[model samples]
Target: MTLSNPADGRDDPYLWLEEIDGERAVAWVDAQNTRTDGFLVDESYQRDFDAVLKILDADDRIPFVGKSGDYLYNFWKDAEHPRGLWRRTTLESYRKDKPDWDVLLDIDALNKAEGISWAFAGAARSPDKTRALVSLSFNGTDAIEVREFDIATKSFVTDGFVIPKAKTQVSWVDDNTLLVGSAQTPDDSTEAGYTRTVKRWTRGTPLTAAETVFEVEKQDVAAWFGVNRRPGHEGLMFWRALDFTRSQIFVERKHGPHAGQRLQLELPEEISVGAEASDLLISPKQDWTVGDLTIPAGGLAVIDLASFLSGARDFDIVFKPTPERALQSWAETRHGIVLELLDNVRGRLSLLRRSEAGWRETPLPGLPDNATISAQNFGGEDDPKLGEDVLFTITGFTRPTTTALWNGRSAPEKLKSAPRNFDPEGIEVQQRHAVAEDGTKIPYFLIGKNLSMATAPRPTILYGYGGFEVSLTPSYMAIAGKLWLEHGHAYAIANIRGGGEFGPSWHLASRKNTKHVAHDDFAAVARDLANSGVTTATKLACHGGSNGGLLVGNMLTRYPNLFGAIWCSVPLLDMARYTKLLAGQSWIAEYGDPEIPDEWAYLQKFSPYHLAKAGQNYPPILITTNRTDDRVHPGHARKMVARLQELGCPAWFNETVAGGHSGAVDNSKQAQSQALGYAFLRRTIAK
Candidate 1:
């Protein structure tokens, strides 16, 4: 794909850099890496790197776990175990400070024995939790190879179920059968490079002989299959049409007049479905008219699956969001359902149970204020028989994370807490609002010390991610606390539009044609900070990644006077060609297709790579990405850096050899990459 330059009717000269693994492209990357390393290998950068690495590799960090039968499993990586170790322990021992864990898999040892750098993707276990399908990836890419393993033997099952590396999905239907989706052939993948066919594979049979069960059009995003087994409900097979936003769901009938056949569900394409026992919970993203009843957007409703399957349209409204309160997530227990609500961007937990009258709500107590609360099913999301127990974590910008276990009748019991990585003695947090150009109120969080003294502006770094309906909430920042706050710098996070901070409306207000509204909201927050004497433009910097990188890219190109430095990581800079990049076609529903005439007219306005000109006074920029990132192509960062350097702008570039989209495979790599970023910020703005 070639991008047209409207001004001079020419093509981008740096387009050759898009050849990710070409000899010329690799040589260019190596040269850029050497230049960046030369500037960041000083004594100050080394000190910062060591400090961040120490905090990351600290053994006092909490080892969070997931319950499976009588064991609690966790994946851990430290100085000794760089790749990581998958281990498990008893619930009783897990509650203790130093639990005795049984190692199930050693990734470092496996890598050594196999002579490959295979990263752990994940594992899907059988119902009995004694066997699992372990997934391992090459260089941390999305494509992975799956092998069957027996927990009792602590070894892979020889000549057992195995799938070669491709974007694949698998679920255990029984000990002898599995519902699988994978690229059977080169032509069996969607345009987005995902599997378009699903099959049923039996034990002791060759994978090529697996029977094709379901398939979708290659133009669609992908297809997936799974088995849902609730406690009092019969097992159900689910097939999903994986479109970007609008899709269809079909369920296989186990025992009925249409047994062994798939039936399409009668529901709106914009609604989400969740099941627990006989209840079918629906959350609508847009207004839906069912029979004579209308369910508003952001509303929750429930219906009996038996009645629904029988063509019954009667439904009961379970919960409705007001202007300030919106449902975030829900999980099921033995006899009750837990609802997580976001009220004005703060989390609130509530319990719901069904009775003769209707579903009733019970208030949960002892939840800390000004912190984000995440609740999960006690065992796992797919636990067939979850009991009346839930696990939760509470965290804030200045407070470390604390994990707890909650029963229905009492306050949450504290299980473990993360040891403090930095001193929070004089830290303070405050919520402030900024009014956008369109008269919208944007909320943001500020963390710093001696805020009462406004005589002098402090060096500050502002962060934001304003797309994909992802909300940014308060969370502890250990590196920021130790490297910036302790040394007298302020940090701020903007809750801009295109985020689910308020509700579906908040995100819709800035999506598609109105994408510029999110950029305006972020700029408003920066101006608010400067006007309040929190910081000056000379001492202000901006940081973001992924969609957030797009956010900061716009700031540097359009409003460079507001920031002294810009750090963009794993960004999508060439908006004109984003849809043609890896996994980029699937996100067209979020970012409009630039191939269309109308969409390109609007998209070109924010295409940072195209907007960057030779005469603009752009801020100093540091673009970082990973060579193994299959999701967002690293060429976006490479091309942007090359364009800026040609324009005589101070630009630095770095790319790691592993870690995929995250740019970090382990604690040491994560710390080292972050240390380079922080060191650049200190030199450009804090000095």
Candidate 2:
């Protein structure tokens, strides 16, 4: 029942906050409430802001692994702390300091700050935590750059195989070899995308001696990699494809030059991976490993670890209630899975143990149903059970994320909540679905209050991201929900088909030549809004980042009259030129192989760059791009803005000097972004 201001941390009675890491916890808080108008939640906390917050208080010596910032992905001593050290920490300092620690990776000389130096992925060490294999990114001709940094010494040792594309996460089978996957960079001119490659890397000299053990054909290359899974079952290898349908499990030999080369098995037939947490986990030195494996059919499949290595094994299916049609976050323990389930439209934590007696499902003793749980990635020195305990954050649909701790042994401890200036009861959000031109159903969430621009048109903001099988679910948005919902009460989110809403099938149905289906779906939604009495072209606004930006670009070209303003953030707008840009070649699977005539024909039909015309009635667009966006280059936003300006269109361009994809680095900056976005929308539509 305590309220506080975010700026001074002063106890204010105006705002209610549920402290997740501290004793004080507020029930309902929303970012949209920060504005004058906003969204709402049920008093029962049954359906509301569905964000996550976790709290733990076992040890004061260390910080809980905080959420990653763009520039400082590893510098989160905490994001919720009113005063935390993570804010001052930079990527350079983190890369410089960690080497002094015990068994830190030595990577100064070879792993340049200017050059690529990402942390290795899927390096499962022995039970003793002694030796580990490293896989990092290096830039080459066809491929940009990536290098492996030893976790123990923080040092770089060797070069990697030349992939015509970029690679992600290196999965280690032993101390010496790694499962390396490569993605082709895009062809900037013709919009050609390179096919992705998957192979193995052994301790050896670069290119001269590096070896490849597995290579998929060009025919089936959508170029996306999945989370590496190492089950307790011997020889059983599981990976969840990033751009595909199901989680494929393979069995290979444990030792040999050809080890892990052949795929002897695939499992969970008829099971397509769905919109779930990044729960593909590998146990360290355990005989049995549990993966929070999701099937498109809904729920989790706790498959038996012995099924891959042994002849017959028992597999269990845990369909934790997902009443909100939202995603679930779970952590694996030798004991079982600590599932942070979503119920009542908020987040809750429960422990499901895999014991000799079968499975044990228990909720955290004292934490209320309104509490939400977040899984900390980096290790902290709290109770071993503290690590096992799922962190829960509780807030109404109008709540900001807070932290809390729930070790299996004890009840729950509260932590700090979001700034008090924010309020949820001030706004209201409604989830609505609209049908597309192809009879495709598109789901969108609309948040607003006193919700109309009767005298004038109210500013309406819309956001969407529909690619890579990633679904944009309706959650407690710190800024979008607050700024747009509260201040303007005119914001909407369209869950288009390119996302993993229905399943992998939903994603694939909108890929390649059919990619226009996604754009069509978005436009259909926009058209519905204009026709539905929500708003019209002169007051309607659109926003999307990454792939969704591409969608926005198409909407501008195809149905230019449907919207008045556009906010394209770090978008992939130049489809014809995308495959030619840095790392652009890796996306052939999603956008289609532009090099081929057939694919080109299809892509040209909807590629935003090809569609941008001099006489086109383009919407007023504010294009935001990043200079150091290692993943999606800022060139996209830049080129599109330049094109619009050249065509005499009103284009406002903002190039983030630093930070990768997101222009902002910290929560404060992000909040400022919210203010700016809301202000922009208000200026354009809300009068």
Which one is best on TM-score?
1
Best by lDDT: 1
Question: Backbone clash tally for model 1?
Answer: 0
Candidate 2: clashing residue pairs, number: 88
Candidate 2 lDDT by residue in tens digits, 316-405: 555433324433455665335766554423345566776678677776555443334455422221223323434455543355555565
Residue 228 in model 1: shift from native, Å? 1.1
Residue 110 CA displacement from its true place in model 1, Å:
0.6
Q: How far is candidate 1 from the true structure (C-alpha RMSD, Å)?
A: 2.3
lDDT of model 2 at position 643:
62
Per-residue lDDT value at 612 in model 2: 75
Model 1's lDDT to the true fold?
0.84
Model 1 lowest lDDT segment of ten: 1-10
